[model samples]
Target: MSVKYAKRMDYIKGSAIRELLKLTEQPEIISFAGGLPAPELFPIEEMKEVCVRVLDTDGKAALQYSPTEGYMPLRKIIAERMKKSGVEISPEHILITSGSQQGLDFCGKVFLDEGDTVICESPSYLGALNAFKSYLPKFVEVEMDKDGMKMDELEKALQANPNAKFIYTIPDFQNPSGITMSVERRKKLVELAVKYNVPVVEDNPYGELRFEGERLPAIKHFDTEGMVIFLGTFSKIFSPGLRVGWVAASPEIVRKYVLVKQGADLQSNSMAQREAAAFVQMFDLDAHINKIIEVYRKRRDLMIETMEKEFPEGFTFTYPNGGLFTWVEMPEGVDAAEVLKKALEEKVAFVPGGSFYPNGGNENHCRLNYSCMPEDKIVEGITRLGKVFKKL
Candidate 1:
């Protein structure tokens, strides 16, 4: 006999991208999947030193439950880092969660109600879509060119759906697509949010990893009202394993998050928070992040060069200034999932792009990650995947 689950279970499902990533576990496969940072870049030694110090100095407090809003010291650092993106706020505006991933889920918990609409890029982060789906929100996907989400479609969606909960975006180097919204679009997005009286969720996990040009001011930087809830994480610029991330919003919204965080785990890991705070205080993360940029910039350049020379004429990919992925678009009518099947047989793997679109049907695309693999593996994997594309 099968057990009945909540009706909400009908909306929630396992991530297709994650399910596909399991296949990448094979030792022989060179995976261009999983938006993972280069593990070598993690400040493991520095963190070890920090952890030891924390244990020696304040082991009891470090191990005990902390505040729901996060460690004040860590929040202060996170708030200060916002200056790079042009936002200037205090630690009081921030609420730390286990990771930005948890922040996404809380977004659903705090704001969404079943049958409400969420506006997003035509193809957005698969993980965000999954998180929001748990609350049974319908997605209204707005089309985007290189600049960002098309304004007309977004305005249209907001106008039609009075119950649209939030406008979700990764305005910096976006996931899967690697599209950066233009400054004009960023400002216009704030204008629309103000006009429609809708909140904006600006997720910026990859903003700090800028490899070239000036980093754009985040949408939150332009907020006239407290309608934008900004999500940030140390996963990209530091280590993902630490699971430290934060949300900055108006005091009211931050309080809403704190209430949920109390129920959703009481607080983030106590020892990890203290250790991360100590590490941040003692070391210069900007200098460490520079090291990461130096390595990733080279890897990105190499991957683009290889793909330029190796891929079939019908295939094209993004030349993102920063971020772990490059979006690939195959010739019309080809399904990337099918291309993935053939590539896997040749020992290469990637996430099919169809999974990124919340409202489906862009089967001719896929995302390739260059950060996790070595220079040699990037070359080898792209070459192998190219053969599969060429055959098709």
Candidate 2:
């Protein structure tokens, strides 16, 4: 039973949130550990109709093998949607992938080599960190303020690491931190990438989920030199189980993704792409997203309010206008993992923020998800967690 594995496997580990999900699966546990969407808001009936229509009209084509570049109609729909984010793109430059998670893997495959450096926000998305880690690259995490990653620190990192592969960012209501990059910073980020001659991988799964303020243009929108790679997904706005996402870049760049796609999984789910396109054609996706915004905005508001009233003094958390998470920073000496142990005793769960950092050592933080739980459960869970933190 002896076997050998690749060296890259040494850098890979199971996701902290994924492991926590298993522990919190009990019926009574009020889990806020996962960045999951509310199941009640899914378009089950519309999808049911869309599925039968696709099968009845184009059954074989729906199930058959598709181009690595994805279904033309779906790509076109995605391209049209890109205009909302201020990017004028064509379907020819889009390559469909299983999910944005796969898009992250492709970025690693295309840009990284052993000992290469990656520039990311200090507390970036855990999933992206794991995906990039498989390539054995060193991470240079930049500090962040309320407006997202700091530009001066990013410039210093870029200057310090000349062999940096790419700058990875979740600019729109960023995961774990829930901070959005301002419009000026978005433009400055592109400027820095252009100057540094490094590509910017914009992981924007939550850009469209804005609950307040005007929507800002994507980083790719400012990329006149085609140095930005935009990853878009249906997981947040539509069905995650469909596993439909795309890489929108320049033609030359996306052709590389298509080649990678052929080697990765051949193509994304054909039926799922067709169904997503049909759903768009058959219904008002904007209205559907509006419904999601209404529900999640209320949840976000309630969670922030409850935390304000219940949590003790000196503990700080973000009041996110949109997205799934809000990060809580405990006092310097406090360990969130210890807080979790006590909270679990009261049938509650959340992700400790230490694992969110690729280089580690911020154990006094935690990420809370409000988009998955009901209002009553959110209140009850935050109250229980408040008591746990107060004890510490």
Candidate 3:
């Protein structure tokens, strides 16, 4: 017997990174595939204390079901944190979700319909692309430069697809490309969004992880007409296992998210919410994030230096100020997937770049993650990848 599946299932495919992770689980494989934070930095000792405190203080509420809007204390903490991004919001306007990935799915649910258009960077986050693809929207890819997505190309796409659902972007240390949008372009993006009357979805998982340079204001900071939806997560800074993230928007927009949340899972994990809140209250989160920044900075530096010395000429990768991954562009006519097969023979793994493009074609690229590997492994992995590229 065959099962009947929704048509959306046909367009949805498993994440390339997720699949690559399975192959790299072997102890000998030096993987540069996943955007994973260093486990050593996780506040396990502090969390053990935090967990005990939560159970001692609010055991009943921690285990009990809560509102779809989320725990008030946690929401207030998130609202306070938004100020760093230059957005002034009240807890009432924020809805906590399982993760920012959930917020991405809710965006597609709220805004997209079959045949609708989505304007995104040429090579955007694979997770976001997959989330939007399930709704069967037509993706209008806009090219990018060093600063970030090309504003002129974005404007052209907005003009062509006047009925676009929303403009999705990762403005800070973007996922695959690791390019940050300039301040000038961030303002211009808001201007264009207002002109087109389209809402902007800003997925910012790495905004606070800056290793150098002054922190840039979020794109939502420039939004005056309440058309920007900011998605924030602790997955990068604090922990991904907790699966805590939030959606900050206008009260009306948040109400829509609240309704959707009720239908999705009724509410997020209450125990996790209390644990996160208690952890922040009991310790210095900023100090903890600084610790993370220090380690990731060294890792990023090592990975970049190794690639510079080892990678063949004609191979190029980004110098990310702060993020998990750097994108490598291979010489023309080379497929990264083919290169990956040879790399795996050397017990090395990475994600090929072609799948990052929703419309597909560019295959001479790959994303290498530095945040997960130690300094020694980073050097070894790059050297192995370098040998693989040189052979081709």
Candidate 4:
């Protein structure tokens, strides 16, 4: 017998970033595609100790079903972390998910409806676009300047789409562009969101990975009316494979997320949660993050240096203070996807920037990840990419 699937399934397209990632597996390819942290930096020995300790102390509890909200201890730690960001939240306002990607999915499920309007920065994170697209929201793009989203355009978009459900922003060291929103812009964004009476989804996975700048207050810090849903993850700071992330929102919104989590997976991995709690308690997470910052900072410098020395004169790139990626904008009329194909032919890979935009358009841009590759490899990869660009 033939089976029929929901019509919504047809609207979903394969993730362009993931498809590009698959092509990067060849040993000859020098990949700058994924936003993965360097695997060498994961504290394997500390994690091993935590794993043994959890099994010895509470193996059964770790393996058994957990409350949909999350492990209480981890939730408490999350609440404490939120306090440092100036967001006053409690364990009651937290819901753990398998990963922050799942948090993105839950956000779409809880807040979005087909044909509802959602605003995102132009050339935003592709993964978020993929997650939200399943629900079929009409994504409105706001132009971004060097400081962050253009306030004038943002105000115009909000006025144009007054029915917008929420504004999603990666305010600190944003993904593809690696541009941090200025403190003034941060305040203005929060003001606009409050003025428009629309909630903001503040995705902040990379905020703590800053290597060379003062930390700014998160948009959630200005959320007096409980209109911002803040998403955080241990993946970047700790182990991504552990798949641990949390959502901090108003108690009322968090309650709905709890019910949604119950239907999605019941709970995040309890063993991972317990081990994460131990990792935070026993090890100096700040020290570990500092080391990561050092590694990535050097790599970022190398990539920037190579690009400057090798790339054509017209090409421009972002100088991010902190974040995994550097965005390169090619000369106008140059297609980034075509450059990507030529670079791949030269055994190098990067995510073409078109995929990052909601409408799949930005032909002159592409994203390169410097965090995962060694300095030498970054030099080699960009050199190869330079050859491709020159040829084009």
Candidate 5:
């Protein structure tokens, strides 16, 4: 019944998380499925006032087309912010993207040709895997343990597949797994990438959300050869609705991204960019981030405590120091998707870990998000989910 479509369409599939979100939208369901921030924490009042101020001060320019590289003031703010992670880059090295997600697609577009190999953590972010697949590149998923992607496995993969475009990683509080890379491995990873002569794309959306423990400097900090590309986003710390994220790389690489961005969406939302930049200029983001940390830290604790009390044997999960997620792995034979079907019937939800892998197989794991739900809901949802696991 359909008309002809591009062959690339064959490689694409609807996002599993987005599909699950529709079923979890009911008020009765306490969903841990999305990497969504709590609406209660959004600076609604601040945003409203900022919008009015921008309109009164400079309406036309704020609403009009902006430079493809992004608003200069915002870029300056981001460049300065990078120093906290031990990275020292000028605004010239940054390319503002719609979200860090766009930085992923552009990496695929900028580096991958059809049949080229792309490497990532075994159970990497599903969104990045989905983005890379659209270009028809072969995926090489390196296995992972508690301390981020295994360097030995990664180097073997890199050595075997010398055609790899780049190594994609989320080194801090990784998606789905909620595991941070050890500082030792961080240096080793940079060394391996340099030894292999492959570029590293370090996606760090959740680095600022640490609730406890030391915040490690980004993998980009160890990059002396300029082989690392760092991606930053305001979505986690500020507001996802604004969709402001940036790419920091060599000026030459950033220029290529700027050109690709022109062919993609021309540029990100111009109005939102100004509103965000103005917000940064006027407000204290670190103070706001502290407020977020307080609430989320408590939520993370409640989820872990409840699961520890209620979950049956053969069920184990991560207790992360920061970020929104805690990963659960069932016994070897159990299928997490099947468990989710039962959890949904009880009005609870989470993302199955299998979909996070590009070449999928491990169906016994799932990822629970703590930032979107309140303390009571976190307790209740995990209790409900625990009962489902027991029955399974």
Candidate 6:
């Protein structure tokens, strides 16, 4: 029997990173493919305590269905955190999502139409690219410099695509690239977005993971007219298994997201929300996050040092102050996807940079994650990758 699927399903392809993750399931492989937080750093005992408390003290509330807007207490906490970032938002303006991934999906549903133009940093987050692909928007790439997205190029893109639905960005330690947008660039981005009358979707799941850098205000902080939709997540700082994240935006946009959320999953898991709320309120979140930073900082240093020592002479990589990923750019004409196949044979895995770009254009680049694997594994993986580079 022939089976038919929705036309939109054709636009959805299996993630290259996820496919690589499957290859890493073999015990011999050392993976740098996933932008996964260190599981070892998870506050498992603390979470268990919170879960027990939620079940014992508020079983009914935790087990029952929640409002599509999300758990009120969690939303309030997220709003308060945004206030510290200089974005004055309230609980009423926030919607809790299953993860920031879901926030991206909701944003696509609310804002993007098929063929509507959407601008993104060149070699942006693959998760976002995947999320927006479901809506079939025309994606235009804006070049990124070392300091992050080039403001002049951004202005040009905005001018060219005058009706671009939104500009999506990960300003802090951007995924795959691991490049932090400077304060100056951040300000310029806000100005451009305002000047062009285009909304900015700021997906910032990694901002809190900064280990050794001056804090830059989020673009949303400067959005006085609700021109920015901010997405945040506990997955990077707390636990991904919890599946908790939030979106802060204008009341109207949030209202639409709430309606979308109702149609999506009714609401995120109430028990998980209760546990996350309890985890934030009862435990020392800042201290726990600092511990995570300590671990990741050390790992980042190890990976950078190993790359410098082991990678081929022509290989260049981003030296990020804080973030899970470091991007490697091979010499021109060296196909990263081809290298990844060899890397898999060598039992070391990474995501080729092409997957991160809208049109699979970064043939010479790949992204390596330093947060999940141990220091020894990082050294060993890079050493193995070095051999692969030598063969090329």
Each candidate's clash count: 0, 0, 0, 0, 0, 0
Task: State the TM-score for model 6.
Answer: 0.98
Better by lDDT, candidate 4 or 3:
3
In candidate 2, what are the lDDT values of residues 1-392, reduced to their tens digit? 97899999998999989998896568899999999889999999999999999999989999999888999999999999999999999889999899999999999999999999999998999999999999999999999999999999999999999999899999999998999998899999999999999999999999999999999999998999999999999999998989999999988899888888889889999999999999999999999999999999999999999999999999999988789999999999888898889999999999999999999999999999999999999999999999988888
- Model-by-model lDDT, in order? 0.91, 0.94, 0.93, 0.89, 0.91, 0.90
Cα lDDT of model 4 by residue, 44-88, tens digit? 999889999999999999999888888999999888987767888
Model 3 lDDT, residue 109, Cα: 93
Q: Which portions of model 4 miss their true places by more than 4 Å?
A: none
Q: Residues 166-260, candidate 1, lDDT per residue (tens digit)?
A: 99999988997999999999899999999999999999999988899998999999997999999999889888999999999999999999999
Candidate number with greatest lDDT: 2
Per-model TM values vs. the true structure: 0.98, 0.99, 0.99, 0.98, 0.98, 0.98
Runs in model 5 lying further than 4 Å from the true structure: none
Worst 10 residues of 5 by lDDT: 18-27
**CA shift at 281, candidate 5, in angstroms?**
1.3
C-alpha positional error of residue 183 in candidate 4 after TM-score superposition, expressed in Å: 1.2
* Candidate 3 residue lDDT tens string, 64-99: 999999999999999999899888988999999999
- RMSD values for the candidates in order, in angstroms, are 1.0, 0.7, 0.7, 1.2, 1.0, 1.1
Local error of candidate 5 at 345, Å?
Answer: 1.0
